[model samples]
Target: MSKPRKPKGRPVSGWLILDKPVDFGSTEAVSKIKWLFNAQKAGHAGTLDPLASGMLPIALGDATKTVPYVMDGRKIYEFTVTWGEERSTDDLEGEVTQSSDARPTEEAIRALLPSYTGVISQVPPQFSAIKIAGERAYDLARDGETVEIPSREVEIFRLTLLKCEADRAWFEVECGKGTYVRSLARDFGRELGCYGHISELRRSFVAPFAEDTMVPLAELAALEKIEDRDERLAALDAFLIDTGEALSGLPHIAITEDQAHRLRMGNPILLRGRNAPVSEADAFATAGGKLVAIGEIGEGEFRPRRVFT
Candidate 1:
């Protein structure tokens, strides 16, 4: 067996934003990346179905700890919806359960989008990963078992109909975590009196990051062809939180090197500013103004939860 050639692409750490290619699940993309860098720990913030593609931020090494922060951020997707037919999965990947001839007007679609905005209740599809009892809901759904999926509240901060055509519409959605665009498409069709499903989906932004920061698949793939020894390490810290403004907002607590050591040893050094509130989640905890560890909000005190070296 011949040895595989080494890659020449930059050694990436911290974070890498990819324009995820279609036909690959989010896990598959992360797996490929892990192989590329030989990275032991890494994770992706959002889960994109095999049929969908777009900005997927991957965290590397210690950056994996920040995955929860990224996942909790807002997501924006531009999706195309067909107004005539609906599918069981509420997307193009699913089987068409119904077909109708009712066409929707642009004006009507615009009016419907506003109603979905803000906080509203929604029911997840039966064919979803949500667990019911001890079995996965989607598993039961595929097995032809009747599943009682309940509706829950979700916030759609923005859902705008960007453009429309006969029996079709394109929309840009900015929603909070846990929102299912497929469910929205289903609801959209139901309201228009015509069943429909999502035909296309693309995530463009993830609050702090956007498509502009994404590296194109075509380019990343081309780099794979080059020799490995030529690649330079890409510093991962570039993806860290905007620390300047956050630091300024923090109560300026100055501490000496001796105090810094004590803080790292699980000691609570007094915050210099009296009665000053520490940030809810301060990535860097300062004692006497020296960065100690990550801090958490506690009852009238900031506690060092986890320290990132």
Candidate 2:
């Protein structure tokens, strides 16, 4: 039998809350971080558009397993809607599709805020990542083909008008996963009798991570100047948040080393004490402050689901 192929690169693990710069794609950021760290595995919790700058949580090595949790968390964005012209892509990148000389008053825009709050149906932009028959909508849009896109429900926890100018209005929003700020700007313009598009957008926060935790791309890039390879890598590693920190939202229990060993060996460990959980669909276990496994609790036992190496 042929020998199993070993993966290259260091087994670095943790979350890197990147303050992605505008015009840089999410995939490109991940690739660049992967190269800089020379990590064996890497992934991002969510996709931030090239034109939008803000908090983008990236997972390295074992932290990649927890990406779904971060992706499902709520996001907060501060955006500016430029009235008078709506673009094809819903942003400045695309050509103007519709235009109007009329503009909305501050009072008029504030009056419409309540209608956009809470659960509402939204249609994604034509230049979106939504798939149509296995092909990306953006690809079809670039080809000059217009397809009917269905509307889906998205929850907006909070929407506030920050400031309003003659032709531009700034707003901040806290919304659930899959909510599109660009679409909100588009819809607002249509309803107010003035066409609009996103002039500036920045994600300020993602759930389970603080807005202040983000590290800029330029700050990380500057670390590349260190002469010694080990010293340089160490400088980069300092910024990594513990992998277990990402699961702060989930129920957690600290187990003994023996229990961690059993979990690592793909075995379940009994839960002791009356306060122990009777049942749980999702939870995580740690030992010596290190993540041991993410699993379930039932019948007074913790069953290992995904064990960390």
Candidate 3:
């Protein structure tokens, strides 16, 4: 009998904007895509809670290095808050802790939204992934331990009341990093004199990606039904977004081939005149339209902070 070929994973690189479905954790979604692409390395820009569904950008290979940039980008979410009950975890997954009969009117909800806009202080939910002394806050919360998560400053660029019903309200928010939608719901209820928790949460976009680029897991699963393995691999590869695209928000500087080589070797390059940015300003250095490195300009020198090889 002929010997069978080994199923070695491929060395893939790029970002995969996954439309993470409800009930799927961010880690599990990364693992699924990593297995599908047979990528050598993989990570994600940010975490999408299990109860929330939408854009979860997965980075393969070198793309993982640019995760910080993407994670720092603003996020947009559409969430629904069902009033009358507050949960221990701040979402439907937790135990109901309090109840109220109050429901805010559409006019009332709209009035409160302006307050949420601009810079605001938000206390993260106790049942969160935030690490406290090497242990997850959620883990400690589950064990009946009181986890005091301090309030932090987060920017909310915009907040809109989409709908208001007798027992529930829907809202859309555009906010900076570390802003939790669940906390918004809990606080919103308190502001309106009604206890509430998130019933539905969906992230519409995560920085550099939109609905057009999101690939549903169902679509990926369908590719496996293809009889030809080579054709299937080609189809899967088509979904990859170039790693350089993740740095689109940053300023770009085109460098010479020699400069690219030196940057890749962990060396600095000199820039003069308009090419040199203000001191300490980070920018993407590219060569022939391909990313060479992400570096900060200081004293006319582009020092490589993260080099892409």
Candidate 4:
């Protein structure tokens, strides 16, 4: 018998970059979109907390296969550090755990911003999603269990102090994957001999995805609720990054057809082509108008990294 045709008006493979409104988690946004489109498969580039807003990329269709590449890319965030207060979660949601009578000076904050522009060790907050003892760290913390989260080395490629007052400062940060803005603020406060916590946060960019391309959740929701099919398609296009586009984001490399075929076979795609591959995880590998996969340089050859799954 002939294969049954798929349902008409089904959503094609794409990404949806939603400007997550405050109080909405990234997963919640994905769930809503999945229901709205009746998608069979979906995922997101990164997880955003309910307190944060901006640039949450939801992957749809086969593009969900590329979500890991986007998730591992560098991220940029704009945030405000409010001094004279320390919260249990290192953000606004938690109760005040500490405070200082002293306030931070604009000059002091300006001077310290440069120190964070490079590599640094950050300890994930106790109230985080990290798992410990078979339960989430946050759950353990909520149960009043004392936990010691090990410090992790995370890179802050760029940290710019935008504005500063007596007790508060706005900042722009470009960091590697897994770095937490709240942790940075908490540590900054410690460095200055005062307390600090994140009061506001907006992720402006995640590597290739930027705020300009982000659609507000409210707007997307309104369109979806109204059954505006055309508008929803536009939203998907706005967020989805095809393989070719994603490959261009990384350093370009060319490979022979045999290598390309091998890459598709899930081999350890190595680094070899026009340019030497960057020693970063999730580096792009491509050639001749197609994406091979993202991989690292090995003994010799662009080893198959992430198959075009």
Candidate 5:
């Protein structure tokens, strides 16, 4: 009997900011995108809870190299805190562990905003991905084991009370890496004398990407449904941002094609005049309008740290 050959989609590269929908996990989103693109490699910068939805930067092939940069950048979130109920997971996913009739007045909520802004201590939810010992904290929590999550200092650049009604309060938070919106909602309810849990959460922006740049999964699925394979591939490719877009925060220098070839060969090339880095630091080097490598510049030489090719 003849065995069938496995299909390999294609070797693709670039970044796709997915407008992740509710009920979709980050890994599931990545898998779907990988299958759609038939990409050899794929990854996401930040982890978003299945209950939350919005900007999720998915990297393909070489673009995966820039995941760390995107993950560390500031994130903006819009969420609603539903008062009178506190959940074990700090969100609607868990059982209500506490409740109260008290609700904070708009004036009081506004006054408390400053305290959450700037650097503050935060304890991540026990039913979270955070590792405790060698196992996931969420695993221990689900097994009914005691979990004490350590508090850490996280930066909240801006925390604003957008709107507040009787049972739900809307907020927008611009925070640095490691800040949890669910935790913020939980803390706000506690501070206001009414227990609460996150009812709705959506990420509007992450680092270099804005809400407008994100494409919903439904749109991508529609594009994939196109009958013509070439047309479908071309349409899908149109949404990918250049790999260099991910390196927007880094300084760049132009190098000769020969230098680029050398860099690809794992060799360092000397820099001169304006092509030199401002100081002894790591920066991006381009050749013929294409990204060559992210290299270290020192003593008039560019040593390739991570070559693109």
Candidate 6:
């Protein structure tokens, strides 16, 4: 029998809402954060394009378990769509594919907002991370192969026109998962009889994480200068949000230390007391303010699905 190798680095767990700057890739940001924190595990809730800037929720260690909850949450973005030019990628990074002299008026843009709101079918941009036949759409696109990407239903909770000028328009949108702002710009251009592309985009919020809670990459980088390793790690750790905080949108139940121990041991605990939930599809259990397990509540018991160590 072979001995299992111990994982390296600290077992730090929590979320870091990074204010990702333009030109930084999501995977690259995760790598940097992992290096900075020296964590044994790390992952991100969603992918933010290199050209986009905004809140990117990253999970370290056990916090990674909660990433799916955040990824499914709503997202809000403020973007500038430039008129008269549509690009291959539907953004400034791609080559110009079409052009027009028409520009939509503020009234016209506002009138179109209702059409985009609610559930609508949207085709993702060619340079998107969507996979086709097990290959990334972007990779196939880069190889000069255009694939028929299927349109998906995405919900735009809200869309508002902030301002409209001769060549550009600023807008804010609150949307559900899989909604592509780039696609919105592309479709808006096509609808208005004017070619359009995203010139600037910034994500202001991802669900369960406040806009103000984001820490800029530059601020995190500055902590590398601390002389003492412990102090440096401490400073970085201070920015981590609680592991359970990511599950704020889900139902939660607090359990006793004994129950928490049973959950950790992969056993179901019976729900008791008047306030105990009789049934819940999904819920998380916490003990002394710390996450214990995420599970389903049924048959008057909490069945652990994922336990936090």
Q: Largest lDDT belongs to which candidate?
A: 6
lDDT of each: 0.73, 0.94, 0.90, 0.78, 0.90, 0.95
RMSD of each: 5.7, 1.2, 3.7, 4.4, 2.9, 0.8
Per-residue lDDT over 40-150 for candidate 2, one digit per residue giving the tens place of the 0 to 100 score: 999998798899999999999999999988998999999999999999999999999999999999999999999999999999999999998989999999999998888
In order of listing, the candidates' clash counts read 7, 0, 0, 10, 0, 0
lDDT of 3 by residue, 127-216 (tens): 998888999999999899988788999999989888778999888999999998999999998888988999999988888887789999
Give one digit per residue, the lDDT tens place, for model 6 in 189-247: 99999989999999999999999999999999999999899999999999999999998
Off by over 4 Å in 4: 1-11, 225-239, 251-309
lDDT of 4 by residue, 1-309 (tens): 999987554555666777888998878888887776667677888788889998888877666767766877899999999999999999999999999988888788878877777888889998888888788999999998879888888898989888888878999999998898999999999999899999999998987775677777676566565457777656545545564553446665767677778888877655545556545544555557566666765555555556664
Error of 3 at 179 (Å): 0.3
Clashing pairs in 1: 7-228, 253-288, 253-289, 254-288, 254-289, 255-288, 255-289
Prediction 6 TM-score vs. true: 0.98
Candidate 1 lDDT over 213-241, as tens digits, reads 88756665565665653351232233323
Which pairs of residues collide in model 3? none
Higher-lDDT candidate of 1 and 3: 3
Best by TM-score: 6
TM-score of each: 0.82, 0.97, 0.94, 0.80, 0.94, 0.98
> CA shift at 71, candidate 2, in angstroms?
0.3
What does candidate 5 score in Cα RMSD to the true structure? 2.9
What TM-score would candidate 3 get against the native?
0.94
Off by over 4 Å in 6: none
Report the Cα lDDT for candidate 1: 0.73
Q: 2 or 3, which is superior by TM-score?
A: 2
Which prediction has more favorable TM-score, 3 or 6?
6
Candidate 6: residue pairs that collide: none
